[model samples]
Every structure is written in structure tokens, then in C-alpha cells.
Target: MRQYLPVKKFEWPWSRRDNGQNEFSPLIPKSGAAKVEDEELGHVDNEYQTGTPSNQDHNSPTRIQPHYSYSLMDYFLKYFLFLCNLVFTVLGLVVLGLGIWGLSSKESFAQEKIGTIGTDPMLILLTLGFLLTLLCLTGCVGALRENCCLLKMFSVIVLVLITIQVLFAIVAYTVQDQIEGYLRSGMLAAMVGYQDDLDLRFITDEIQLGLQCCGADTYRDWEVNLYYNCSAPGVLACGVPATCCVDPLENGTVWNSQCGVGAQLMDEFTAQSVIFLGGCLGGISRWIKQHEGLIGTVGVVVVGVQILAVFITTRLLENIHRHKAHA
Candidate 1:
């Protein structure tokens, strides 16, 4: 109309040309709408970079890595148990060796002596040593290799042994009089065969020397033996062993084997001066009473150590299960 000429359209520097429509659109606009869109894009880009949005829902479960750790105490206890068990294993081997030596020295495997093998003190030592060695070895290897089966077996055996010891201790404490009677009977039986059995003779001699005691009841108790009886033809008749004498040495050096000859013929007043009048049973009882506190302390410590081993083994097992689960 007014100019009757074509009007030139103004386009922003950031605008794009629409070929057919001749429309111009800005890639980046300067309006508030453009500002809002720019902020939204920046937020999305931040989310992509950080892996999550800042406005994430609080109720949603979070993803975090599980932490597995062992403290210094754990390592210390593990090795400590291993070392303790190793020491016991060595001690067990020593005990087993001593037992074997005793049996071999005594010719206990002879056909005639084999009948008494079951009741031999060396057999007891051998059995105890073997069990200790086997059990401790299991625990040692198990701790080192973290073997669950071995640990469980060790734990079960220890538990059973503990239970047995507890029951034995209880019975010993509750029926002391009966126990003493049984001890007396056993002592008498040992005396009856003291001459025939070298093992019993050695044991009896050791008991007499260690306790400074004569016999089950008195020095005359040796007469129960067939060779020591007053009616016997041997020189040992009515004679106690040299071990029962107050002084079994002559001139302070020579062994006075005949010092106890005719000792049974002496009166109680005279015999009291030559030999110990007390029996081994009383001496044993006195010894036990005197050392009860020490015995209790040792027992408690042993039980505590076993309990600690069980606890450490259980913790290790739990750790293994946890690691496997995670894996």
C-alpha cells in the first residue's frame, strides 16, 4: 500500500531459515522460555554426568557396596590359636614317644604281658597323646587353611572332651569318700601283684618315693605280696621295700637294700622312726587339698582357651559364608 514495495524480514543472528515458510527460529532464544529450557537441559546433563538426579526420591533404596574387613584382633587370635595348638601337638608327640619307650623297655608287647596291656599306665599315656595329637593337628591345619569341616570336627571333639572332664570333676568332688575307697582298692590290688608286674613295681616305687609313703595303709601292707609274706621262704619275707625306709642309703651313698629287712616285725613306735607311717592315699588327699586353687586356675584357663578357639572358629566360618555369598 503505502510503499508498494516488498518488506525485508528481520532475523536474529541465532535464527534458522525455514525454506518453504520463510520463518526464522532462534536456536538459543533470549526470552524467559529460553532461560527455563536452558536450565532444564543443564539439569539433565548434570544428572547424566553424576548418574542420578539431585531431586531423587528419598524413599527409594540406595545402592551401596558392602564392606568386608578383618580387624587386628581377628588376625592375632587366629594365629595365636594356631600356635597354641601347634605347641600342644608337639607336646602330644613327646608324650606318645615316652609312652612307646616305656612299653618297649618293659617288653609289654610280649604275649604273656599282652593281657595286662589294657590297664597299663603307658597305654593310657599313648591313648591320650594320640587323641591330643590328632585333635590339635586338625585344628592347626583347619586354622591355617580355613577349612570348615576340620574346624567343626575339632570343635565337636573338644566339646565332648570338655563335657567328659566336667562330669569326671563333678563325680570326683561329689563322691570323694567313694573315690578314696576305690583308690585304696586299686592300691591294694597293685601291691598284690607288685612283685609279679614290673610296671606295677615301678609305679609303686615311684608313688612311695614321691609321697614319702610306705604302702596302702602302712609299711606292713607289703606282706600281702606272696614273696613278702612272713611265711614266704625268700629273704623279702616280712621285709618292706627299701623305698619305705627313712634312710635307704648307707654311709650317705651306698644303696641300703637291706635297710627295710625285718621292718614289719617292729612295733608301731619303733617303725614310725624308720619309715613313713602315713599311707599314699592320705598323702594324695593332702596334696590335692593343698593345690586345689592351682588346679582350679589351670582348669579354668584350659576351658577358657577351648572356648576362645570355638569362638574364633565360628567367626571364621561366618566370614567364609559371607564372602561366598558376596562372591
Candidate 2:
């Protein structure tokens, strides 16, 4: 007389058969007890269930766990970070080469002609550009690796650097002459010993023809004697001063009966100053010429860093979304 009762619908984990096996039934309650729980409670529990179901089971792969646990994000981040660092490091190497070339360039020794050389602010621009390029690479690495502290540090450094660069550019462009004058003063300070006071005495044919030839001797008659007597001693006179000559003042020698410390020191100072400043500029130009090949390499590295950043960011976003959907 063992009779089987009708199976109820909507049984949860507690609903088991006589054999102690789960029937895998749905968890809908019967209509009779549905009136006890209010709509608000039902709504709240429903919301909670829906929200929490994604992470309830440890055995299920459909769980919203962090990708860092499996080193998924770590691998990508590391690769991208390495790329960024390598790029910047190589760029730094190139820049270092350029600096060396600048140190040895011949153009640095050439004299700058008057009204020919314009102020370019090259040193400031190059320094800032180099610093910023390094910072951007560092920031990319920090961001890729998800290092919060590094990221913050890099961000702050970059921001401050960019702000300074912008301000400098603004000021430099607005007061270009003042900036040029400042730079010129600095150069002069470094090369002021090259200044020289040149005393150039250019003697022409008139001054060379000393004591111009006088025909009064050949035509020394009564009329010539009378003409000579009536004529001034210096006016239109022959055998006057003739033949030009350059009378360069001897070093340390007094001229015009004036005596002081040796003036040759001034000439030496002028020559040395010119040499120093000319050497500086020549060195810079030489470096640019010597490391010309490195410019392309540096450009490539920079582009590579940018590309890697984009790829890593995309991969991170994709991984997050994929894991989320599965969960």
C-alpha cells in the first residue's frame, strides 16, 4: 500500500528524494503560501539573489574573480611595461650619444658673424623634451602594471614637467629678445676674454705718397721762385707724403706717449673668450650631425611605446569584460 504523492514544483536544495539525491528542481513556491511574503521582501530577495548568484559557487568557472589571481593581467602588463622602458632607455642612449657628439663638434669653434645668429633656445627645449619623453614612458609602465603608487608618482611628475615646459615656452616666445639677451649675457660671461680693441690705421695712396714730388726744382726760374714765395708751404705741394704703410702697434708698447698695464692681455682675453663660446656652439652642432642616425631609432622607440600602451590597455579592458560576462 505504498503510494507515491505528486511531486511539488520549485524545490530548492532541501528538496530530495527518498534515495537522498538532488532532483535539480526549480525553487518556485506553491501558490498557497505565496501571499505570506510581501512584494517588497520578494523584490529585495530577488535583487540580492540576482546580484549574488554570479559569485556564490567556488567550483563554478562563472565567477567574477580578479584576473590578477591567474597572472593574466600581470603577463600583459609586464610585456607592455618592458616595451615602454626599453624604448625610453634606448632613446636616452641616443640622446647621450648626441650629447657626446656635441661635445666634440667643430662648429662649436666657429665664430658667429654679427646679425647672423638668432637665439633658438635649443638647450631648454631639448632638455624639457627629453625629460617629458622619459616621464611618458615611465607613466605608461606604471599604468600597464597597475602599480597605483608608481602611477601616481609618474602622473604627478609628468604634470609638473608639462606645466613648467608650457610656462617656459610662453615666456620665451613672448619676450624673445629678453630671453636672447639673457642667453647672450651668459655666453658673454663664458667668453668675454675674446673681446679686442682693434686699432686699424688704413693708409691710402695720398698718405703713402709722402712729400709729393715738386717740379719747382726743374723749373727754378724767376717766375717759379716768385710762385713758390707766394704759395703756402703745404697746399698742392709736390714731394709730399707718399706710399701707405700699416703701423701695427707693438704688444705692451706705449703709443701716443701713454703707458699702462700691458694691453696684450686684452687681446688674449678676447681670443680665449671667442674660442670658448665658439667651441660650445660647435660642440652642440657636431653632436647633432654625428648622431643623426639615432634620431630615427629614437622616433621608432617612441612610437613603439605608444603602440604597446594602446595594446595593453585594450587587452586589459577586454580581459575584464570577458571575465565579467562569464561570471
Candidate 3:
């Protein structure tokens, strides 16, 4: 009498007791031990079981995620960057060595004038070469080793330099009128050492010869030099450098060291026959005006190269991150 008839088989739409628990939508969907709704929530859950069951769970260590495959282009770009930086590094080293040699050969460290070394224009070349070498070396090693730190550092420095250059350009443009005054001051300072500083003398000579002009403003500006002043007792009194002469060589053979002697004391017509009548400032301004387009183009190219480098570095860094994540 107590025996029950065959239990009526009924299937619930959202319930199943086959696994001893109600199923739920898999949050991470691929699995054997799927996470279900909390038991204490008093809610029914659902899950779609497939024909083939997965042995892995949501927390399984062996999860299948997409892996990044580096293409040939990536490697090529990496090595190309490395090679470029390496080449620049070598060139920087050469320039730096040459600067050192120039200074050393000139005995720039001699006790008598060592204190004036800071004013030497060769320091500009040395600084540029050293900075180039440091930045390139960092970039080269960073590319070769896939080092994010070095790459970031190199990119930051380059970006900073580019920013500085842009700001300087803006400032220079804004102060264009005063630039001539600044140049005059700098020229005067350099001329003060024309006889004592070999670097200054060479630079001054080159400028005069190339521009076919004399002092900062006029040939008579040589009076600023004590040795060249009219009141000086020296034979070279009131004379300009040989570089300012109409022809710096005698008979196109011997060096005419005294060609400019007493040339500054002559009238304009007389001086015109012996030396250049124009001043250097006006020539420099004209030269700059003529080359403004070229200067702008070169600046653009340099900045473009740096921006491209930054972009390339960012991509490489991203790839590195992806590969590390995959690992």
C-alpha cells in the first residue's frame, strides 16, 4: 500500500538535477566547474552545456588566450632603429674626440688662459657631440635589448629638446628686432679675445672672409682692440685683421699679414680699395634672410625624425608589453 507508483517524469524549463545543482549563465563561459549563482541568494540559475565538456574552470591556470606573433617587420624595425642609433653614436664619438683634440692641441688648459676656456666656441661643439652620443647610445641599447626604461628616457630627452628648440624659435622671432643688438654684444666680446683666443680668431677670420665684410658694424670698429686703437704705439695701430683685406695674399702667393695695416685710418674711398667696406652684421642678416627657407626645412626634418622615432619606440614598447603579458 505504501509503495509509490513510478514518479511522474517532469522537466523544469530552467532547472536540472543531473549534476546535483542548478546551472547558471557562465560569466567566463568555457568550462567544466562553471561559477554559479550564490547558493544563499535563493535564486535559480541556468547554464548551457555543450556536446563536449571542457575540463578547465574559470580559475584554471591553463587558460587559452590569444598570443601576439611578431612579424618580420617588427624585428626589422627594431634592428633598424638600433643600427641608426649606433651609427649616430659613432659619429658623435668622432666629433667629441675632434673637439678634445682641438682644445688639447691649442693648450686650452694652459695656466695663463685656462680660466677663459668657458668662452671658447669649441665648447659648443663638445657639448653637442657629448649630448648626441649619450642620447644615441641610450636609444641604441634600448632598441637592441628591448628595454623600456632606456627607450622612455631617450624619447623623453628628445621630446624635451624639441620642445626647447620650438620655444627658443618662438622667442627669437618675437625678439627679432633686439637680436641684432645681442649679436653686436656677442661679437664685441669675441673680438676682445681676437688676438688671445685661437678659436675666436679662427671663427672671426672665417666669418670676415666668408661674408666679405669687416667688424661687427664697421672696419673702424677695430679701434675697440687696444692693440689696434689709433693711440696705440704698436705698428699694427688702427689696422684690421688680414682677413678683412681685399686680398689676404701678396701676389697670390705670400701671406699678406700686414695688408690691412693702417687701412682703418684711410677714407672710405681709399679703404674700399684695400679692404671690404661693409660690416659683418649686415652681411650676417642678409645671409640669414637668404637661407631662412633652408633653415626652416632643416628644422622640420629634424623634428619629424624625432617624432617618428617616438612613434616607433611606442609601438615597440607596446609589442614588448604584449609579449611579456603572453609569457
- The candidate scoring highest on lDDT is 3
Model 2 regions more than 4 Å off? 1-82, 93-145, 193-327
Clashing pairs in 1: none
Q: What shift in Å separates residue 214 of candidate 2 from its native position after superposition?
A: 48
Span of 10 residues, lowest total lDDT, candidate 3:
39-48
User: On a 0 to 100 scale, what is the lDDT of residue 197 in model 1?
Assistant: 73
Model 3 Cα RMSD, 1 decimal: 13.2
lDDT of 1 by residue, 203-251 (tens): 9989999999988977878888888899999898898888888889888
Which of the two, 1 or 3, has more lDDT? 3
lDDT of 2 at 212: 23
The order of the candidates by lDDT, greatest first, is: 3, 1, 2
**Model 1 lDDT at residue 141:** 90
Across residues 196-306, which tens digit of lDDT does each residue of candidate 3 receive?
A: 878889999999999999999999988888888888899889999999998889889998998999987799999998999898999999999999999999999988888
How much lDDT does each candidate structure score? Answer: 0.85, 0.41, 0.86
Task: Give candidate 2's whole-model lDDT.
Answer: 0.41
Candidate 1 Cα errors over 4 Å, as ranges: 1-64
> In terms of lDDT, which candidate is stronger, 2 or 3?
3
TM-score of model number 3: 0.80
